[model samples]
Target: MTAKFHAFLQNGTWELVPYDASMNVVGSKWVFKIKRHLDGSIDRYKARLVSQGFTQVPGVDFTKTFSPVVKPATVCTILALVVSCGWDIWQLDVHNTFLNGFIAETIFVHQPKGFEDNNYLHHCKPSLFIYSREKITIYVHVYVDDILITGSSSAHVSHLISNLSQTFDLKDLGPLHYFLGIEFHRDAFELILSQRKYILDHLLKINLAAAKPVSSSMATSFQLSRFTREPLSDSTQYRSIVGALQYVTLARPDVAFAVNKVCQFLQSPTDEHWGAVKRNLRYLKGTIDSGLIFSAHSSDTLIAYFDADWASFPNDRRSTGGYGIFLGSHLTLWRAKKQPTIAWSSIEDEFRALANTTTELL
Candidate 1:
């Protein structure tokens, strides 16, 4: 508590104020955490003081309306120079930092109960400006999905169909023709999987599933942001399409990264994010024939490659790491994940990636 309090004081996170009867006051509480070593021994105890910020009023307390210091032109100019001149790119991650701006409002957090400090007077102003880094608070949007059933047995399939027909309002679409947008091709040799019909229907649903297919998964210089000024009104449609694209990744690993990036803004999708999703879908339109192939070949050898992008995230500047593992010359496992801790250097980030990949190999 003392360490955190002193750190807060040094950071100037908030100013002490007197108890005010007229203005609304916010409450705060202490949070506790424990850090442990690799051997599971206790390393240290951590405490944080968090404000109950739900009490803050919109107009009276703070205003988020502000202009960006770095204009769109500046970002484009820098990127254009890099593309043309082939410049080296560098990134850095610095935590506990904010773009400190002056604010005219004078709001305050109330003093803790029973702690009478002279500095915490009745009416005091605390927060000076909004921090550039804010904690992620996710509000997941829910959508209902239908279950698709499949198995290999004429007798068993018939028995299960009789049971389901007895239990609920069942429509017997014989031979597993098409269920939940997935089309199946089965014969004596093997059963093939494809979403050609589903993709086409959804494309026509959005009036672009059949549009000219693009060669790229996503266009170069794709601009996406969480704080985009213009938000799409059909955010629900965006969410649904993104969800479908996620299912498509089950069969198509090529578009996984692009789809994963777009899925981040399901709750509040911007027009830019929606456009990126459409680009990915258009890519899928070209590669609808792409599907996983079943093979009997097996090998005992395991091969893996790991890499990391230092300070990849624009919002928090956190590094991202990923690895791909191949067993017997076939891809068995692969993942792309963001690093938990910020890396100070490229070497540090790559070392962390190696460590994580080694763990996965084990």
Candidate 2:
């Protein structure tokens, strides 16, 4: 670890100095992990020095923090495009991506322990990549230390990694297989996306592996209303249900509407709501193998569908609006939301729903 820090310093990755007249330095720590192969063999020892980014203030430490990731729909569309056009699909990963992103704010960080220069113990300067190259169309999807770097060419991707590795101690993971719990499988004909392992693990964790599955997410008789005969005594169960359902939506858009409906009652749930939540879980049991499968046969054309249930809630009289966007045969994006304003007519409600969907589409 000391040797790695010395290499980082020699490469001009960061310069340690006294805290200057700039933003406060966030604290940092070393994280160590052991990499293991699928066969359970020891792969390598990994070490990371990371900033405590949670301490960063929203506007002060960072503004416009929204970094667009390749959405599920986008992923499907890209895969479909690869299939249709027969474009070679390759996945590349970056090592220590956050270290490459240049900080716009004059943020400082504490000198890493044990490797701190005695003469420069007070502060450390930022050496992020974004700070140095403003014009490059370099976008990175970061999940802590792991990163997925997508580019138009393998050479471009290689160049970016080469440049980055020059500055930081980096290990290249050739192609992406598992990212953010989603598993990827690629072949000459198709690129498959699934979370079968994740789903099974989740079900086992919630003690629902043996539960009976249902045909649909909710029953036709099920109606969620704001008014309830009795309030739920345990709120933790309600939150747990919501969290589980949220993860279920990764591959199961069918449950999205039902989950969204139940989520609306999170603040004040009732016995009826709890029953509905259980019903959704039971539905998951039957459809455990169900997930979004993005085939390479999909097209590039984009189409969207929108619908609404006006005044569906008896308590609030709020309408529920839902929209789904498709690229070719693959569904890329869908959203279920409640309308902000009450409408007197179905036409008015539908029109408002269209407006909302348009905003999202734009």
Candidate 3:
């Protein structure tokens, strides 16, 4: 807690101010989190001073909200390039990231409970920035404070890190073994990206870790419908699990279709929908180690394959379709989603999926 408070001081996150009865005072609290490694081991314990931004009056206190996030496809593409080129990849983490943002809004907040400085005061503020070198080329992908850096030259990469550390509080986490919940396992010929630990953690969280593994993500006979069975008494757990499964699709495209099917009924989930979700989980249990493998011998050619299921959803006549885009031999992008509008024929649905894939490729 003291370290977090000191970060606020060093970053000039807020200045001490006198308490005023008329000021819109936002409550502040300490958020504690245990940082863990990819193997589920404790990396460190972290605490951050956070403001209860929820209590603020929206229009008055904040006019716009923006989140600068790197696209997943972009990250995958870069990683694939790095693996194929046999480049050096490194992960970096910024300390006290949120404290570095400069907020223009005049905000008031109560002091942190234990580390209250001068009674009551309020302040607040909150990277997608990249740096590159000359002909050797370096790529830096930033998602908030977490960074993934790679370059063709090892010495150049080290020099870049040294330069970055001088300006920012940086943690050079060696080679990019893990970042953003995905684990990268690399050998001489290939790099395998997997979320085995994430999958196991989710299974344990939902108490399905002991369930028998299944061969398929979704059973052929498992057709879910909102009215097929009684609605869940409380839909919170159903929504929460389905939402969590969405993240799994990041590394597990094999379950993307199954997850997309279950996600359709988030609003009014039934026992049948929950059963399908459990089946997907069981399938993931069996294939927890599966992931996208980027091999070094990949070609530069881009290939795309798309297919459609005409009017597959019983609830809606909309067609279900998906596309897989491969660069050389490695799959770079894939998506399983329902069409926005119902197609008149199978060919029309197929064409829709093809058009979508072509758009993505372009």
Candidate 4:
């Protein structure tokens, strides 16, 4: 993986230069994994070179880092339009896509292991830019190395892919089946999105395969308090559970509030919190097949809903604000967070939540 990234850098894909005095360089690390076949056979050993984006300081390293993404509703709307118009929808992937993005901040990456250029000995520079070539629409969705590219015409898609292939070795996966862990299936009538495989894998990983599933994500009367019976000995285990549940909520919004509530206790979890976390896993066992599905729909309108619970947190008297945004029938974004300030009334709390949601929407 390091070698591949080094080659990408060498070919004017992206570059490593001196870190800017004003910008903080986010860390990078190599992720190693093994690929497997559908039948559980080993495919090959793989490695991912990723940026430790968590360290990025919001305004210094990146201003306006939030990139607008196609909502699930938008995706569904497009699918529905395709179905109604009888237009062919094809998926194209651009391999090593982040390499194409020009970094505005001066940044440097340690020469990849085993493939370092000894001659350079010091610094390297990037050569690619948005205007380097014009055959392709540069709009690309990047989540690490995996990318999904779409264009208005097949010819445009083909031209873009051809141009990208010239820069780096490109793999044509043909049509969008799976990207970003979401499974997609399209036919003449409709398109379906689900995370069945991911959910099953998650359940098994958390040892909840045989656990009895719950009907809903949380109990109706369930409430969490920072004060609990006994402190957990290992906070790491609690955090691991929180991390797993966070991923599961990607397809399961029913558990978003519960999961976000429990995540706050990662720093000092208790037995009560642990029990609730386990219950969430049990809930997952039953809803392993549940996922956001975008069908053929007519709505292209975007709407948002916001709410807040005043003084919900007993420890700090902080309110919890929740919001969900929808493009049409599909839920695109949802957040549950503890407000920073204490609210005197429910109305004030709701106002704050609305402000936050509006900021996010804009």
Candidate 5:
């Protein structure tokens, strides 16, 4: 706590002031977290003092809320391009990210509980920043404080790092081994991206670490319906695990269909839906190392494959359709979702899937 307060003082985060009853003072609290490495080992402990923004009036204390976030597809597409082009991939982290932002609001917050220096202070995201020029392009993708950088030339990329270091307290993490929960492993021929540790961590969270692994994400004979089985007495865990599984699909497209099936019942999930969720996790347990592979020698030819399950949903007779898009030999994008409307025949369902795929291709 002392160290955190000292760092806040060093950053000129806030000034101590006498309490005024007329002022709309906000409360502050310290948040502590453990920073872990890709191997699930502790790296360091972190502390941050944040304002309880929930206490303020929206239009008065704050007018608008905006955070710049890069799309998952954008990151995957660029990564594939970089690997295919034989470019360098680097990672960076900006310290005290919240202290660097420019704020126009006049706000006051109570001093932290334990280390009150008789003062009050006021406070604060694009996830991606890119620089591109003719024959030279540098991509600086920021996920909060952590950044993933890649470009055409190693020299220019290092120059950018030097410049960034001079401007902000930054750490160049050298090679993009990990970024935004995805781990990158590079070799002579291909770049393998996976979430092995991420999967295990979540599996342990739900106490499925020792469960038997399954080869398939879903049961081939299982049917999904809103009214099947008894409704879960509590759906919080079901919803939470399923949501995490949805993110897992970012790298494991094979489970996309299974995840989508369980997600349909999120509003009121039943025991059967919960069981489906566990099955997906078990599948992940067996294939924790599975991920997208980007080959260095692959072509840039874009190809797509789409398919549909005709009248798969017994309740509504709606078909589920999905598509996988490959950039060269790398699978960069894919989605598994139920069709918007019912189709009478399998051929019509397939055509609808093709139309969706074509739209995504463009």
Candidate 6:
């Protein structure tokens, strides 16, 4: 706690002021975490002091507090592009990035525990800074503090690291071995991306690691209905498994359609739904060894395919549409979703699915 307070003070995070009752005081808390590498080695212990933003009034305290995140598809596309050329990947962490934002509202947060402070509130700017030169473009994607640096040239990457090091308190973690829970393993030719640890942890979470394996994500003879007489005692458990399964679809595109089917029942799931979830888990059990491998030999060609099952939803008569985008020979992106508008015929549903795929492709 002393170290955290000292660091905050060193970063000029906030100034200590006299207690003022007129200003609303927001609460602050210290968050402690242990950082680890992709190989399960301890990197460092982290301490962060954050304000209880829930205590702040929306318009008065801050007009907006929003941050953009890198989309999973964008990550996949970038990875495919990088691996297609077998280029190097790197990661950088900006220390105290949350404090980098420009605050517009006057909000006060109570001093952190074991620290002397009066109040707190701050807004942030883009915080994501980028620079590029002719034939040397370096891009940084900042989802809050975690930054990913990648580009075409090795020299450009190194230069960007030097520039970033001079500007902010940054850690140059060499090579992007891991980012956003996805692990990268590179060889002479291709980069293999996997969520093995995530899958094992997920299996352990629901106590299904030792369960019997199945070849298919969904039961061949089973059909799910909206009606449920015997709902699971804990609906959260169903939601939890379904949510985790969604992430599993990241590397295993084979399960995308199956997982999307389960996601639609998040609000009210029953034992029947849980049974289907278990079936999906069992499918994962059999296919835990599979992950996305982008080979350098494959051409960086884009191909998208779309199809639909006209008026398939038993509850709403809405058609189910599916699309897959392939980067080279690798399936980089895919989705299985219910259509928003009810289609009158299969031709209309096909056209709708085509339009959706076109939007994604464009």
Best model per TM-score: 3
Each candidate's clash count: 7, 8, 2, 0, 2, 5
- Residue 244 of model 1, lDDT score: 85
Model 6 agreement with the true structure over 1-362: per-residue lDDT tens digits: 67556656676776655556577788888898988876778988888878887887777777777656766777777778777766787888876655455666666677666654323323120433446667765567777678887888888788878987886778887888877777788888888887877787788888899999998988655556778558777798888778888888878788887787788788888787888888888887788777888888777778999999898767888888999998888777899999998999999999999999999988
When summed lDDT is taken over every stretch of 10 residues in candidate 1, the lowest stretch is 136-145
Model 2 alpha-carbon drift over 4 Å, by segment: 1-14, 19-25, 29-64, 99-104, 112-176, 226-241, 268-275
Predict model 6's lDDT versus the native: 0.78
The clash number for model 6 is 5
Model 4 lDDT, residue 151, Cα: 44
- CA error at residue 333 for candidate 2, angstroms: 1.5
Q: Between prediction 4 and prediction 6, which has the larger TM-score?
A: 6
lDDT of 1 at 336: 66
RMSD of each: 22.2, 5.3, 2.7, 5.5, 3.6, 3.4
lDDT of each: 0.58, 0.69, 0.84, 0.67, 0.84, 0.78
Clashing pairs in 3: 101-126, 109-122
What is the per-residue lDDT of model 3 for residues 1-362, given as tens digits with 9 covering 90 to 100? Answer: 77767766786777776666677888888889899987678998988777898988888888887777777777878878887898989999987666344568778877778876443434322133444546677777778779888878888879888998887779889898988889899999999989888888889988999999999998787677767989889999999889889988888889889999999998989888889999999999999999989999988788999999999988788999999988888888899999999999999999999999999998
TM-score of each: 0.47, 0.75, 0.89, 0.76, 0.84, 0.87
lDDT of 1 by residue, 292-326 (tens): 43223434567889888788667667777888765
Question: 130 in model 6: Cα distance from truth in Å?
Answer: 5.6
Q: How accurate is candidate 3 locally (lDDT)?
A: 0.84
* Regions of candidate 1 where Cα sits further than 4 Å from its true position: 1-193, 220-223, 358-362
